[model samples]
Target chain A: MNYRDPQLCELLAGQYVLGTLSARARRRFEGLLPGRPDLRRQVAAWEHRLPEVLGQAPAEEPPAAVWNSLNRRLFAEAATTPASAPRGLFERLGFWRGWAFTSSLLASVFALALLLGRETEIPGYVTTLASMKTRTPMWVVSASPEMDRLYVRALLPMDVPHENGCLLWIKPEGSDQYYLLGSIPEHDGADKMLKIDRKMRPMLKGELYVTVEPVAKGMPEKPAVAPSFAGNWVPIKI
Target chain B: MSSTPEVLGDLLARCALADRAAFEKLYRLSSPQLFGIVLRIVRDRDIAADVLQETYVKIWHRAGDFRADLATPITWMGSIARNQAIDTLRRAEHRITQADDVDEMYDLADDSEGPQDAAARERDAAALHRCLEELQGAQRTAVRLAWFRGMTHEELAEHLDTPLGTVKSWLRRGLLRLKTCLEGA
Candidate 1:
């Protein structure tokens, strides 16, 4: 294997990307990569060229659990306190979600609740939190009073502002306060599971909102922005 | 979410700054195609999932290393995925169990798309498809199987039932031609 020969390097690099290189040969090739920009360029060229040969392989979405597993392993800390950046209008809104939100979120919640009222009672309180602006479901939130588990599942990755983070809060029935459940699952952390504090179990019947708040360590005074997505528990008999 | 180079490049720039939102959006938009490619090479859902995780972790960290001057976003990212998948396959080569279930091996492309599918891909993909069509038939399938299955030289020799020497000769010729055709295009 002459590492100096452009022809041999191209052959090895091409097969490496095509994956036909034997393990020993591939290792030898890689050992040569960092020191040899020519080899690296050749390898990158083959890497760029070959996959396109297949044109497009149909996209198969990985099993949903993979995303959750990634969040746990990769972005755990960021979830706890998304980066604390400059405070904007996000930190000023406080726990206030009423009056301003009742018009849209409440109206949709009433409609969905009636839609679910006809179904049998299961143990879980499920809500599909849709964007208030676009009316597209962004997060499917579920709280189980029986199991004391809270799950926030993102339907699609939602974008959080650079200086802000999205948090899940439940406004328990007849209560003026919006209790923080946990950070809402974003594309990075798609399937987040939060434990429903023992005292918060009774609030399962209330409204669910995925709200935007300034990036702060731990819980904030409350969400400073109105609910980006809001819904009520659509009970499922599971 | 579209993966235009500009969009993915912007996402990569943000990811370098530790922007979780951009990283998430990048994963959401790009994972499917990368996963599809990996699932073909690794051939096991569990291992493929593991490989996909490793690939993205590398991407999140390596986003800073990406050179727009070198490759398109998918190519750069796709190469990471294929490298991860192939590495897993080769490292566990002696596992000798699931790897033997050749009957379960996917076709040339896991999800079979036809000529129109080739046309639908971006210019690079389409050009490669055309260049591939020009290769000798044996070399064409040989390279495709090597790519899709991540087969080693010995495995290719055995799988194709050709002599090891002949497979190497033909494969090298095939690869050389592919490079020439692609570069010329």
Candidate 2:
């Protein structure tokens, strides 16, 4: 559709403000509005002129819990996340400033990739997750974008509860949502080549976390509780 | 918490600066109408509350993007709420009410006019109301249901007992005419 056509712009904007656009269409239009001043103006004009329509709805105060939870979600969440072993992967080890340590971590990741039969140049993203308390690498996680594969190597024994297992989470850059990669069962071999959802392959560069969640039944669609572990992928130019 | 656009816009400005107090004030002032619209559309209070939460989260994050010149505070916020509800309704396997037998449900929908309606009426909405009056009966009702109930094209078609194409043309025509009428007024 030619958005430049004044008539089409007006119609789309009006339908948008009138609350008739489909969810998909509305998102597409909204996605377009940032670049289209004419469309934005039309949407604004409809909103400005149609206050009566907006006002015709009956007003009901939302439950107080709504505000309470909203407050917690936006404000209090960071302070409350219990980190039994909470740590950022690089900062705690001081790898950020110590070039030798960071380089060795990179080398470890490459070695693991080689052991997994992946091309050395094709390890798209890799990270070493160390236990916050132990200050020793616990897991070396890597993703091969070319094969859409995720591999986890247990450098140290994971001491999760018998009933619970490590739940891997992929958080794309700038997103609050955590996409479940897969579960790492208790008996997951020392070097387990895990199958991640192919959709998450491209999004693997942002962050990777392994939270302790129940995996007895299967991987729950979402983590049952707040994530305990928070860490990012080791960015690899290769 | 009652406020004019200037006050609300100022609150929004402060919210943009990451002031929780300003965000709370904005929510307290604007949430009644926003919640009201969301509840009426999504119909389930639980879902409505969830949708409202998402709406305010977006508003808080995007408060800096508000252009005071282009839109009023409540309407701008209300549009976000409405859009979120409609989007939720589409994704959720919500129910059949918005489909086949929609007219009775549309008429019986919880909200038609309330304090906000009267308050908005006394404000400068007189010209817009007059403009709305000029659309044909079907167009006016379709527009009203779409606004207040968040009715979709299929819902409006079923409710109006008209063909889908006819309903779409009617709504589009109604909006075009209203655009012309409102711009003139």
Candidate 3:
């Protein structure tokens, strides 16, 4: 049916005023009202008639932030409209300003690297952890004999996904057996310390080795995952 | 006689003439009220802001065509704001299914008024206000549910759990009574 029909126009107008018209119909009505005074009058009449309802409804105060932003936009439009008027939003540098985009990207990359890297340091003992591939120092290890404890820290460059925990491995120099110490605190960019005793007596001169393994939660405690952190523990002779 | 709509009609004409001051004044006066109306319909502050901006842009562009013989300036702008908001709602896939039944609840529908009502309406704001007060409970409900809630006739029917025809009649009759009340006053 043609929206031109008087009845249809009025019905649509009323619904438009009432807001019951579907979005499509409402848009059509707006387009029609400009060209058709009859339709516009019909809508205005409904609006005037409903003053009681609108009046009864409490007025809501909009946020000051909106007003502030609107003022800024209007001022900018007033000031630069001659020069900036031709430029759309993307063309303006202000739209791209600030740290929002770069900050989030940097955060995600850092997390991914920290979670994936495997390496460890044991301070105060002659410990060395090997790279999973080369058995080379993933981290430089140094320890004082007086400390009576081992600290393993990973210094890998890329982020690691650590929704799963990490594993720490230790084997005294000249020993082939790898003893599991425990897991590193996940995703924390701090020195991860592991306890040790001289009774394990594993460290000869520069004999202790520590390796990092990334492990999933609830995995059996028997073995480690990929070796992330490894370094030779060098003793500080006093 | 100058009414609020007539005053706004004049402002819109000035706005059409590229009167930046008039446009600014119009924006200051109308945006908050329109924002509130749009916010109620869209229920999201961000989306409502987007619709509000579009509505004002249309008003600024089309202010010249505004006629006292047609709609009050506020009502015309309201139409733009409401239509944009509803369009947004539709694009978001928020439309209702067939379970709606607006028929049985609003049986007393009518739509007799036309453009001629404008002159008479301008003369009697008080009478219109009174007649609105006199609208039956269902009529008031039907109109409010339609206008503010942005529900369709079928949606209103489903919402009120009434038949489609009745809801339509309630809206029609309610609007007619409201028009008569406004015109008589």
Best by lDDT: 2
* DockQ of candidate 2, scored on C-alphas against the true complex (2 decimals): 0.25
Each prediction's TM-score against the native? 0.56, 0.57, 0.47
Q: For candidate 2, lDDT tens digit of each residue in B1-185?
A: 56667667767765543457668889888888889888878889999999999999878766656777788788788888988888888789473463433345444444344323356556646676678779898887787778766778987888778999999999989988887886687
- Model 2 residue-pair collision total: 0
Query: How much is the lDDT of residue A91 in candidate 3?
Result: 35
Residue B91, model 3: Cα distance from true site in angstroms: 3.2
Report the lDDT tens digits of candidate 1 across residue range A1-238: 4678878777888888887776677666766664577877887777666766644455789988777887777787455764333223232221122223334434444443454457522335566676543345666655544738766656576667776778888777667788888786678336666887788787766766778877666677677876666666655553
lDDT of 3 by residue, A106-205 (tens): 3433443343235422223433343332222333333335545445444343345655555555554455566665565433335555565666434533
Docking class of 2: acceptable
Candidate 1, position A128, lDDT? 65
- What's the i-RMS of each model? 10.1, 11.1, 20.1
**Regions of model 2 farther than 4 Å from truth:** A77-238, B95-126
Per-residue lDDT tens digits for candidate 3, residues B54-165, read: 6776676556445555555666787677767777876785544433233332221212222224566555545545675698877777775565557778877888788999
Which is the winner by lDDT between candidate 1 and candidate 3?
1
Q: Cα deviation in Å at residue B1, candidate 3?
A: 22
Ranking by lDDT: 2, 1, 3
RMSD of 2: 18.8
TM-score of chain A of each: 0.46, 0.51, 0.35
